[model samples]
Target: MSDVLRQWQALTASLPVKALGLAAWLLAMALVFGLLERRFPIRPQRFLRQRLAQDVGYYFLGGLVPPFLTVAATAALVWFASGLVPASFYAWVASLPFAVRVGAMVLLGDVAFYWAHRWSHENEWLWRMHAVHHSPTELDWLVNTRAHPLDLVFARAVSAVPIVVLGIRQGNDGLDAAVAVYLALTTLWAFFVHTNVRWHLGWLEQVVVTPAFHHWHHANLPGTLSRNYASLFPWIDRVFGTYHLPARQFPTTYGADRELPQTLGAQLASPFRKPPS
Candidate 1:
């Protein structure tokens, strides 16, 4: 209990630094993707499009809040998981080279994220939470931050928990570094894929996710909702039979057909609220 409280205190103390780091990332992404969208837009629009303020609200709320919740959620999961896995496995994992561990984490985390994202679409209750992310009619880098805290926590935990569970339980800095690398890769890629920039990197698209690939996932058209579920790697979707990309084409429309609450507070409360009778 003392350890948990100490950790919580440390985490709270670090919020300012974390929030500033996220702000830097958000600003850099906005500048880079903002310029790309302006130069070669899939759908030409202003920097401050409709609902920009709401998405910005989600940026801080979704970005700042989830780490706190995910730590608790993943800590519980890691406790149970560590007990199930043998000590030898973690020792072996800890023994591996730093680059190897990072590569392994990236592959493992991406696969977990693929299924978690797909489940969010297939499951009704999860969709209610995830719908907040898809509520935007416009697609841009800022929109990537527009996710419900529950949605953010769920997706993050599914990927992060397993990695932590399989990681060096004795607090090896290598495992810690590897997990950081995996997160950096996924976080930057998520924003890139959500950007409004019209990019289709020929053969390279097969290796990594691109805006065109993920834009189809956000497509409002029927039958396309279930496609492009992978975040970092397209091969996961290919293996799972969810990959869908067409040459010289992008989603004509964005966002879900179903109505979601428009405001941040309402959207946060929406998942728990019953629908109109």
Candidate 2:
């Protein structure tokens, strides 16, 4: 039994370290924010109850579903692709001086992710799938995982394809490492930006995406819907002329004006349901 346990540990050790690090970061943030909400206490008690309920639901769904599905799907796809691709391809990329591969993955990954994100918004059918994420009535840490499985799979597959294609072209472990680190950091940032904590880094929002910056994206107000699309960097939105900065106050409401179905099964099926006319 001890030997079997040791073998299992060795097999699991190959899992990305970033995923573990991100889990730790999210737990710490949740604790800090939970305490802050208790201390500061946002007004309108009814609103607080609603937001809290939604957050609880968010975490429940996150814990029960999406994470496991995503990990399993990604692991399987990578394993399958590994078998078909030449070992020499990965080896060649790995042999390149580290800086070149790192730079390539970062730029290419962001570009791929940018298009995938934009498409999720622009296509109504895809938006239906994406809307599960936007359906949260309150913006908070847990809202990050409310995405539909199809949207999640599509976005991840698109984001990864560029790196995989790069690996095929140049053959490198550095690309894999860079992608793993980026995925971990981006996942943590998604949670951080969704968090209710009031921490702000001021003008740093222009460079690194922050919680306050993304909270506005969840704003259901008329004009706010079209703004703040960039996932990691604000410059992409700015460069493309889609950026919109909210006034000093956060928006008072969230979710579409039309009532979305409340049940989890209903939400999963929502993408196929007719959109509000």
Candidate 3:
């Protein structure tokens, strides 16, 4: 227990600056989104009103919990694994060429996340855990954290498997660097993609994931609700043939057709129970 605490403190100490920077950036983006929503309000074609305070509160609490849990769980796992496995394994894996490790981490991580995300949609049991995310009637930057704890935990656990396996099999610093960079970028991109800003990068949506493209995923429109599951790159969607970019403007509606819980307890307990019928 003491060793675990020490390791946790060390990890947090090493990462504090980066975490603080990310928090600052997210706060700034939230402010910008709030300002934009006020300036160029999009009339809701749906019933829900913007609950800015609730949304901000949800983001603050939800965002902090998952990352802390993820990091702690990951650190514990890695620490234990290091004890069981030969140090040479991690060393060798980390020694692999930088480009190869980076490529492997990005591709493997995204593919893992992609399948996990798609399965959440396909499986009724898993969908319960994921439904809290879709319950939000509003689409804004903070709304991205509106996920059940189980859903977040499962996703992170699954995603880390590939990284862990790679580290043990080939142990390389490049892979570590790649994973770090990917997490940082993806975290920022998630906030940006969920923002209410209307900036579109023209043809770039064809390649990279953008706020406009992601907002469409949250759209309550029947067509878009079933499309755009890719987290970072659109190539996975295109390859799987699930990509659907409507020629029409963004959907005004958000959230599922069914009603969802508004209370914190209900949202936390949602994954275990069936969604409202």
TM-score of each: 0.93, 0.72, 0.78
lDDT of 1 by residue, 172-273 (tens): 565666556667877888888898888779999989999999999999998788999888889999999989999968989888858987677888898888
Taking the tens digit of each residue's C-alpha lDDT, what string does model 2 give over 1-277?
Answer: 3544554465456345635554675578668755655554332233354545555555544544454445555555566668877887778776878777777776676667777877887888888888788877766666786777778777877766767654733543455676668777877778767766666577887787777677777789886766787788878878877777664456677775456787777887888989778
Q: In terms of lDDT, which candidate is stronger, 2 or 3?
A: 3
* Model 1 lDDT at residue 23: 88
For candidate 1, give the lDDT: 0.83
Candidates sorted on TM-score, descending:
1, 3, 2
State the lDDT of candidate 3 residue by residue for 1-277, as single tens digits. 5665776576567575755765786678757766766555444222134655665556655555566567667776677676776877777766777787777777777778777888877788787878778887777667887777778877887777777755733543455566667787897788778876666677888888877778888888877766788888888888887787765356688886556677877767766776556
Q: Flag regions of model 1 displaced more than 4 Å.
A: 168-173
Q: Rate the local accuracy (lDDT) of all candidates.
A: 0.83, 0.68, 0.71
Stretches of candidate 2 exceeding 4 Å from the true structure: 1-29, 36-95, 168-178
Candidate 3 residue-pair clash tally: 9
For residue 63, give model 3's deviation from the true position in Å.
3.0
lDDT of 2 at 209: 77
> Highest lDDT: which candidate?
1
